[model samples]
Target chain A: MSTTEPDNVALNGPVVGRYRVIPLIEKGATAGMRPAVASKDVQEALALPGTLVADWQDKAIKRLGQLVKQRRGLRVFLDNCTKCGACTDKCHYFLGTRDPKNMPVARQDLIRSVYRRYFTLAGRLFPWLVGARTLNKALLQDWYTYFHQCSQCRRCTVFCPKGIDTSEVTMAGREILASIGLGQQYSQEIITKVKSIGNNLGMKPRALADVLENLEEDILDDTGVPVRLPLDDSRADVLLVTPSADFFAEPHVDGLIGYAKVLHQAGVRWTFSSQASEAANFALFTGQHDHMRDIALRIRNAAVDLAVSRIVIGECGHAWRVAYSYLDALVGPLDFLDPAHSRVEHICEVTHQLLTQGRITLDPQRNAGKVITYHDSCNVARGASMGQRAGGQFRIPRELLAASVPRVVEMSADTTKQKTFCCGGGGGLLTDDMMAVRIKGALPRAQALQSVVDSDEVTHLVAICAICKTQLSSVLPHYGLQHVQVTSLHHLVGDALVL
Target chain B: MLGYLLTAAFVWAVAGSAYRLIVWARTPSTLPMPLTPAPTSRVGVVGRLLLELLTFRALARADRTTWLASLAFHYGLLLILIMHLRFVWSQLPPSLVPFIGLSGWATLMLIIGLSVLLIRRIVIDRLRYISSPSDYLHIILLLTLAASGTAMKRLWPVDLYGVSQFLQGALRFSWQPLPESLVLVVHLSLVLLLLFVFPISKLLHGIGIVFSPTLNQRDAVSAQTRVLSGSSHSKTRE
Candidate 1:
């Protein structure tokens, strides 16, 4: 909110009216950083000039240069391409949007040009010779727009012979752009809320407590069962958490209802804490590593404080990837969190196991007559090694979908395992502001669904990721798709619960 | 002049490099994976062909300025290849002789342009930051090949007729020994080096991009564009 004048392209500049913006710290160059004054007043702030500046100067610059090298290196992926187009017919978004640029090769070239100009000999010496473009403000905007269009989905890599990862490039682009202070406002706003209120929804402990109290009342009205949605209860056996969207939104709330019903039926000793309740981390989308780490820290600390046995994540896709892939490395060896006491399971996986064991009877007809198809969230299916594993762990979602709706059909060119298209929302491009790309990016998936709708008369779109659900719901209508309601895999379980 | 043994080796090396470049340029032929089938029909085929020729990438608009320089380098490189080809025939087709001579002169200008460009990469700090070891090696390779090949063809034409006859005999598989020459040796060595380096380095992308999922995608899916600028997308505060 500070309206201060911005500073130089390099080195320390003026802080936005209040906080002092330190010189862009160069990695390996040990630039000294003075502690920010606790007081908000700018003039009273202290400065640690010479030594601090010198420390980080060379190192930070070197790191930036290294990033440029990686960008330049990606061009090999660009130039060596055979244009055989083997993977073209495979992308779900392309089927959905009909845009040529959505294809993986075209998508990567945008980022590759910047890499060439700054990193390659030809691009550097004869900048006009090798098609290398300089990275300026306008170019930065194009990258942000185009990179966001990719959901960090690994579908292209699965089809690619060399396994070139567009997601990695998108992440790199985000970080490089962020270092230059060119982050999007929507993601930035959410990060601000996470930093200030401890949750992406700006839900502090007290606000979350109120929401839980209301949720308990709603559960009583729906099932006539007095279920207590516990908050901040210490020493609970299982710590269950979900995206804030579920608590306030439709059908997702029903999905939450299903979760409560399962816990009660099984007599599982699980608790939901208001203090660290959010499972959705938008920071992952914006490439805000520290923000993501902070969110993870709160979750870990809360679980440790309560002495929970296992942490079960609700039906949020990328959050689970961040949890499974990064949390252990980023916030753990939580010697404090006993390994035996801490395990993360996707809700669908847990529910499917419960059903397979015959602990819960499923009513097949509850979801009857709905020709249903499933959209694999990129994080769980593509980025993570969950569905791709050779044995049973990967097949859990497919089996559950089939069992729930007897009419489950596979989406076209759908990568069941490591290959999956991003929902155009994975990197946090899910909001209405990114609707143009979401509309285009979702085309491949929608087109696949349309085939089922026309040929098989499918009616429902089942998804495991909340972002995918949100994105598909908005995109389907644009294509004249009907009655294809998007809901979590578990909500279907709650419907078929044979109580 | 070196012995006939060196000439034979030099000719063999140049042939190998030409084989590699052609393979690198036309990677669709050796594909180990499934092919997306090049777009069919007059419009699609013509569009596809043009894209192939120009390496047309919409996202590459940033490199619009480099088009002329790249055209010069590639055109020069292509011309030099044709001149070498003319040597393989005993009697140059009367019509092609003038074209070959023009291409020989063009190669000289291209080498000078490329050298200037390579030096720029080394001197510019921003450009230097991202450059890799192979990038420098590639520039050196091309320039060296051009310079050496130009010298052999225009400056020193020692036993030019005998060299042409030797090349024709090799092409015919008669196994004739090549005429001894230093410029030809250096040019052939550089060309061979470029070949061995192709598969391992970024040069590999020349074959890889065609199979790039983005370009080859058969689906008509459009990715949604972002409404917000990246500069405003700060999700974390340091």
Candidate 2:
């Protein structure tokens, strides 16, 4: 294969450099990968009673009006984009797919333009002149095609001069689409599963108990320690509400193993509640506020029923964001939980404290074979904090990694911390149909990881979010760096824990 | 006739701005969407807003060229606004007299800043793609206002005493004939048009920044225990 000149690389195609900058393209409705439409069963599960309505367009317009009245962020964001282009180059999807519509400002304008035509005087008088368009069938199709492209990662909000959050706009657009009976099948299906089976994967209580039993057997055989992964034990001091993926997915299961080992060594009494086994709430992804509240209420009820004083969440990025930021607001007066400790604590925060306080010891040499780097999952990095400090989400995880690993190298500074890129599989776009979007969107992150691998001999890419772990694991091979293993931050901790 | 139009524009601008503020205020922010490493206290939020307002700190951190142009444009407008106080007040404050003389410099800065911003929107690939006709029109309008105001100041000087008398008369609800210079008339008309559009267009960003949830909300989630509404879940949990 002849290598093309770097300068000759097309703007709308991938570039090879220190970091690959994907060229801009017009990836409209048929971008080779579109999310499946939400089925009727999924609609009923989400309590969206109007899914079968014939007048969806009118209903959508009315729903948009109601949302604008309720949410100040939606109204203000619709008004505030000066289109300064600061956020144009900031989106990972824009960087990866090279689609201009993937740019945060343009993505927001998809809905903003419709809002203007209906709401603003200028748009009503001269729609074409102001780039405003009527909310037609074409516009709604664009909303589905483009809004799904956004990971709802708020990286663009950090650099925004007006602090206009595009995620809020994306959520509003998704909500409007859902109101009119159009919803992405992935998030909708997951919500239905969580509502009925108490987890996204729909693994029943017996399956969950069986997985825990197998995990216990493997841990005992390997580590010579009989660490119990207890379930529904009301007497426990802490309740662990983790993503269902931790019980099923590969690297994610290892992260769960780490949590079990840390809890075992710390001598803390923690149990998983079967009633609220899953922490990942896909309702947030679909912007169904009522469904989000209903899912969170299950956790609150479980905590009350179990009489657990403190609730600790596992390594799920958006789940932690919901737990830390929105849980209290949605279903709270969590006054029953211990106020001295955070009502909900990240598993990393707990493990980091244990390591620092000498309550749990780790031998970094156990992980000495691998040189590691951490990917700041966008939701946890920008949307939530870990400990009391402002950027504890970024710091606490790295601290745990450094304590557990022999050597650690950070990815490019621009691509880490508050300005981190998404792992291309968030915001409920992790279905098989959206594989093309997922792969292209992973380019920017893959390029950043590639840089560290080339220079620092980094062997493993660590992530805290299950989606990130799975996405990176699948996409890293396409970048010609398949040897680089995608592992979890807790997986390393578990390896080094001196049991 | 020109005096009445200017008065009407000013009234519309003020009333429209009040309505915008009321709309924003009436819409409740049910969730705390503060972008973190955000301030966790009320005082900290004030400090954050002050820094953002005075320096455009966030923009500066994101892109320096845009930050410099925006900072110069806003500060230049502030200086020109202060100089306009000479028209309303019978006796200019002694401290302000010295700065009023710098109107020449302020005018130059305003034009230069507007030109830089206009050039950026025109030449930058990303910016040019996003620019609507109105975005360009906004800058063009401001540029014309700056140019006409500057020409009247330096090239074809207007009767300042007569203009001030007309402004003072208008303030006191009395009609006075506007200055008979073409440059002065154009300048005043342009200013009126800007005010008319200020509350209606993206220009509402001036006030929108203060109410920005990300910039203004405190990040004190741990301190406040949210009281849920009396929904079925509340009773079910109990």
Candidate 3:
């Protein structure tokens, strides 16, 4: 017998290296499911010692156990469910989808079942006792698809007897998935761009300069105003951070146009920083808290560098949420800006007040529609809790909508003032990849709109957030809604300008 | 000697648990939901309380398995508390022991039910996900207390005189020697650990969850009713 054996084991066939096929760590495989590769880069980053590939496997297994344990903790609630449906009537998705899976309780059970099996001692020991199957490739894919369906609306939590935040569970799941290097590609890419370039759209200094130049051109063409859109405008009276979409997209860009026109008309000194122009922070959507911190840091730094007083966040939903909810705590207690004086006003608020004070005039005649409904973005209206200083309380937008549009019909289940419906776009579902779900998810609003659309004969849907404008505009057509252009609450004011 | 050590440990644990309970009780309950108009009542206070009890919906609604784990663990713990109250009653006037006994049996049954749930956590895969070392310890401590209490009552009755003396001494900070009963010692010791660890761990969630501000914020149904005051400060003076 030869003393030396061939290097090839032919275990499964050469997938891991030249001679060895790494057996799938997970038990079954579906078609197109790629084998887990232990990249040298990954190995270097993880700092794996020796050729112990099993080390990574073991750590993942341990983390899986921890994840499972957390999931199991969630199970106690499932088994005890009274199913009073308190949370049922509360979900916008369920109300929209009419799909039971969209129901908060029903949606929770999907992840809950998996948790029961892997973590609970009964599930682990009995295997068949509770319905937990080992998390393999198929299950992981399911987690990816369905988990993304949650928009983290926080509505269900209100009805929950115990304040169980499903959003937290969704976030934890996403983070766990990320740890395994199985992050949602688009979301991860957005986070990465935000990390490196200061914006999710990857508009760095040069790209932002180009965008400003283009925006100025459009501004000159449309309004004939030689507006100076400054970047990092030092010693400015105010620094405005508009959502990146305002520079590029329609109706939203019009919001920016309205902003410039309002600023110019009021003779208020303000500047836009090229570096921190984006108000829409996708990090909130991805549940990447650190990245959110980084983005907030950059915005704060830009404000400080520009020596501006107030930070006027242009119409964006979650951006306002981040600013109002976490900005102070994260950047905070600045000596230059009094906590009370750090005026973080929504554009609708600023313009609305200015209008009411006779600083800005609106036509209200231009928006002479039979019916106009204002859709409150979840983040803007409902993100903060009551009693907090930054709760904002949805006063400004409501006032603006009431004033700017005629026949302001309320959505059947509209959470406008306080309990506004999510645009189904928050948490970064505004992009096209999640388009189907986004369109389908818009059904709740559409169904609510149906009664008003028919009875009230609504023609225009007003929104303040850029993402809402993009998502609702793209989605409204699918629901047989036409001529109901999704315009910003600002657009209504701008177009109907009595100026 | 071991009995004295167990008793000392039990005292330490109870003191710790009481401290935690106070902290948890005082923490505020504010949820971060959008400012919707609050429902007049979720069918009123009595109806709401019933819903919380029957559904445990708040906890269950967070995620399912956690709800089950928590409910089982909680109901079980509740029963254990009732049984312990019986011990407190034995020292009370004779009339109270009968009242405590009636409640104790009901609680005993609850403990047995919860123990089944506790055991299930280990055996079930799903429960294990959220289960931590502390979780297992909690269940074990609870189970031990329940079992030991049951064993003392049935299999090995503790000397009433010794126990009474010990209780009196423990309460007064006097040195009346404790009676030696293994079950009593285990029961008492586990109770102590549960207390000391309460504030620092997820167990505090029991109190924290009830008052979580995120749940209490009125849902955003109506926008703010007030009109914009004015824009005197619109100019953002540098």
Candidate 4:
């Protein structure tokens, strides 16, 4: 991206945060983001209170106490923040809304205030001094409005001096809300679908099979090969667990096609299971440990049932974060599977390995007209990894882009790696209800993209995460770069794969 | 006696910080939530954390002004704390005696550091909004402490031997006359109050950083290696 070094502000160098990254004091820009439709009766599945109880405040506090005791990260984050403001402007929501509460530290304070009142000695003695507040209906409302504003992207965590990840605080807040019979409809419904129908769209086995069949026919028409999209194949060597969005949505489905083409070219047998159909775990958004465990178990069960040796997580950001970072803890050990492979594998890791070994070749000229820049999805960049190195998550996608696309331009160094911005719609905030937050949140990425479009003449923007694709596509036009459409990293790969 | 007040503050600060540290360690980490591009090894994590603690490196990247002010304040605090060991310790370790001589300039550094932080809190709307009354009180308290400490250092010129003897007596539970200077009394009283509030206030960040999952965690996530990484991951609720 062409970073504009404003002469007045750029005293020495063009800092990444020179323009529009700083919060401009727009109070209530995000305050009215609205409570997402709370889930109905579905709370029973998560063993939550079925409805708002008379003792809802007590229930929420009790749940917070349980979470603090159960989750050390949450307890420590609540205790550790110094209000140094390192993370004050780090949140995209805060940048977008300028609502001070949208700031990560302030958003965290929504619950930490309650934590102080109940748990800390200073808050109990002199609540005003520590910004502590007792539980109340109005304050609980603030908990929902502000915490939901967070995408749980972990962007703020990167810059926090204490490394206090506000996402953990947001997750804990959501968990407390659910305990008091308040839950996000978007996340809860998705979790219920994964629990009941095996996918987020509630796509029954027949529907999923039909979609795969259509995808296979499309691949055959395009490539003139009998490339198959295998479903529940018992003889498969790899189990491909991907977000259902990739099975149905544009750009996302192209990534699915890319996976199949690569697997077919590499001569590796892989299959997708309707049972473990969803790689995107909504339980992560809800912060329900038991539900997160149960959802991840479906993958373990599917691997066992399908008799696959390896499980490859698809190109969804948060899904990869869960699969790579939390799968072992959530689903127990992978001893049942083959030991030669990693316990959990990212789809990009698998594809990168193939590209490295010359198992497949790409004709970069196939994407000749497109100048591309990669958007490092937040969850994968900060919450997950690829290859064997620490920053492999950032490297592998760009490497894939470079190998597959002819003209690849790097976005701002600041916004491309661990400092990447969220796609606004992650953390289960991808529903229609949070459109305002989504649009505002997309501003920083949109500006970064506009700079690239102006300087590098970058035409196509590509990202690995499904949420980033969908969010960027929907939101970029609002910022005047309507010509820029977000595509999948593997879409380019599918385009360039030399048959 | 002032000894009892000093003892209470010492015991509370140590016990409170330790108590929070212990609770953080005991609670289940549940998942590996390392902010990535994170170090993949324990040594790497330590090195990165040390850089952050020592330099406020992340703040340098996020906001340069905060980093400069914070670096000055914290390092200044460290140096000033060490300089005070002249009064606290019966005798300085032979090596530290050399560094203690830098206390004159370190006081200026401390005042400058605290001033920038205080001014930012007063001027920056964002910081002003995020800061509580106690945040202001903290800066004011520390600034006043520095001013009074400076007055004793240069203006009042209290009996150094008597003050050192008084501190040693407080630690040993054998009282000694605290050099009978109003400035010394003001400085010591503020120091005692700071210690008493350190653990209860946001100052817990001093200890909490060690147990912070995002900072202390390694980037590598293997189910088999989960034990070494997430130490308290045993699921008790389930």
What is the alpha-carbon interface RMSD for each candidate?
Answer: 17.5, 6.7, 10.2, 8.6
Tell me what fraction of the real C-alpha contacts between chains A and B each candidate also makes: 0.05, 0.53, 0.17, 0.71
Candidate 1: regions farther than 4 A off = A1-63, A66-103, A121-129, A334-342, A387-394, A414-419, B1-201, B204-238
**Cα lDDT over the full model 2:** 0.82
Q: Write the per-residue lDDT of candidate 2 for residues B117-235, one digit (tens) a residue.
A: 89988987677777889899898998899899888877999888889888887667686898889999899889888988888889988678888898888777744543211111211
Higher-TM-score candidate of 1 and 2: 2
TM-score of each: 0.62, 0.94, 0.65, 0.94
Tens digit of lDDT per residue, candidate 4, span A236-342? 77899998999999868998999899888887778999899888888888888789998999999999998776888888998898888888888868876555574
Q: Write the per-residue lDDT of candidate 2 for residues A425-446, one digit (tens) a residue.
A: 8999887777767777777787
Question: In candidate 3, residue A110 scores what lDDT?
Answer: 53
Chain B TM-score (each prediction, in order): 0.64, 0.91, 0.63, 0.90
In model 4, pairs of residues that clash are: none
What docking grade does candidate 3 earn? incorrect
> lDDT of all the models against the reference?
0.56, 0.82, 0.58, 0.81
- Chain A of candidate 1 compared with the true chain A, TM-score: 0.79
Candidate 3 yields a Cα-based lDDT of: 0.58
